[model samples]
Target: MLFSLITMAIVGKLLHNKGYEIEKLIPFVLIAGLVAYFIPIGAIIIWPFKVLFGIIGGILGFVGGIFGSTIGGIGGITGGVVGGIGGLIGGVLSVVFGIIGVILGIIGIAIGLAFGLVGLVLGLVFLFFIPATILFVVIKVLHSETKIAPDRR
Candidate 1:
């Protein structure tokens, strides 16, 4: 459909940068064209629905990401690495454990997310205690010094 092609072209320009491959984009456009050609009315409705849900999902994902990154950016960097490594290991383990290997891959990601959250909380608690602890020690040391070396007039 003409509508699909036009919209897809607009979306491609908006969604992707100059380096984006046309080949990869072709499938998306083709799918959109097919959906438009078959369900023209539905296409109009889908846009608003997609935009609404996308905004909601994007906001929630952003907040969750901040929480995860608070610890050591585990959610941002380590999370991807762990997921990739887990998938690779799981693939290998599949030869021996079958479906359990796939489950392990999912579990690996869950563990990484859990570790990041716990570390973030623990790190915050430690930070709070650190300055207070240092100040207490400094005050104690100064107090002890005054007694040890009395300034007699």
Candidate 2:
């Protein structure tokens, strides 16, 4: 989490230095980070599982097709239809989950940007404020020290 925040800040700072608006580029940076780091890693981790599932599903499907064929006529058609429907449902669900992931990613980026900006503003305020305040106090003390008292006589 800290690493990601630091990375985002660095990327934004670099872009800001290049005269680009960080706000507009943050999402692209985030997406690039995700694609560069996460996606390939995720795919590498998931590949074996995907292959295993595919083989298992194929074997089960073969057995199911044999069972359906033994039952003849409508049973075979029904199994095929059911498998098609299941595939359709799975496709829809993958799309829905993909969309949800995108939406959540966008929301997360927005929140991070908002917090980063707020921190930046507060930091700038305090960064100047503390020094300015010390200068004001020092000036007042010096002015008081230099001022001569009026003669009582």
Candidate 3:
């Protein structure tokens, strides 16, 4: 799990530096790692390496997002099942509501993805603007040279 998280973070940073927006991939990688950890199938052989590949693959352009989204869909299914089971208590209505909650959670996740994309764009814009503003102020101050000077020559 720790390795998976670290790998995802590194890949995410690398992809971001390479002009790729792969923020959506993180959750997918996380889910895959969790499944690998829990499931005793042949995942033992492929899981670690797949995790590595996923991390690296997701560091690029739309590719990472695509892979991540795919994995995330799988994860969503598992999550829905787990969430529904966990919430299945307190009567029949609770189970029904739990199913509804699971569906809502999936919808919420989709909404979050949209918001994440928007936030990424806004954050990039802010990154450029904030630095430019700071630089402009610094340049103006330097040009004016209005600060008090030292007494020494």
Candidate 4:
């Protein structure tokens, strides 16, 4: 599953760098990942190389991004090389960050749920006492005319 996700991300990035819209390809990638999951033999075969190649790919991609950015400054082939490497790095980082975000989101939900009743009670108090009272005061102030004492200069 990890291998497939990583591979799909890499492929998606590569294609995106080539100017293909990744959104359109997401379904296909998902389908491919599903197909890959069903095939255990392939996963077993790629497991050993997955880590080794991922590191190598990342190192090479970093070098390529630097090189491409330098060349990209001049225009032309820069887009292809630089974009691909940038996309490669971006894809991997996105997946990593996405996972982290999900984890944090889960933890956040648990925390929020734990304190939910407290929050609701506090919110009701504020709503009824603070904002509602403030709004009433504001409306009264706005609508009521102030009586000024006659000037007795």
Question: TM per model?
Answer: 0.25, 0.41, 0.26, 0.28
Tens-place lDDT digits, model 3, residues 23-103: 666665566556545664465768999999887876775776888899999999999998887776546787789899999
Residue-level lDDT of model 2, residues 85-128, one tens digit each, is 99999999999999999999999999999999999999988999
Which ranges of candidate 1 are over 4 A from the true structure?
1-102, 143-146, 150-153
| Residue 27 lDDT in candidate 4 | 78
Candidate 1 local lDDT, 24-137, one digit each (tens): 777776776676677775567799999999999999999988886686675568888989999999878876786777789899989999999999988987998888898999
Ranking by lDDT, best first?
4, 2, 1, 3
Best by TM-score: 2
Model 2 regions lying over 4 Å from their true place:
1-69, 72-77, 144-153
**Across residues 1-153, which tens digit of lDDT does each residue of candidate 4 receive?**
876786677767777778878677787678767766676756688888998999999999999999998787768666778899999999999999999999999999999987998899899998798988899988997788985457855
Q: What TM-score should be assigned to candidate 3? A: 0.26
Flag the better candidate by lDDT, 2 or 4: 4
Q: Model 2 compared with the native: what TM-score?
A: 0.41
Per-residue error for 28 in candidate 4, Å, reads 89
Q: Counting only residues 3 or more apart in sequence or on different chains, how many pairs clash (N, Cα, C under 3 Å) in candidate 3?
A: 0
* Candidate 4 Cα deviation (angstroms), residue 32: 87
Which has the greatest lDDT? 4
Clash counts per candidate, in order, are: 0, 0, 0, 0
TM-score of 4: 0.28
The ten-residue window of minimal lDDT in model 3 covers 32-41
Q: After superposition, how far is residue 138 of candidate 4 from its true place, in Å?
A: 40
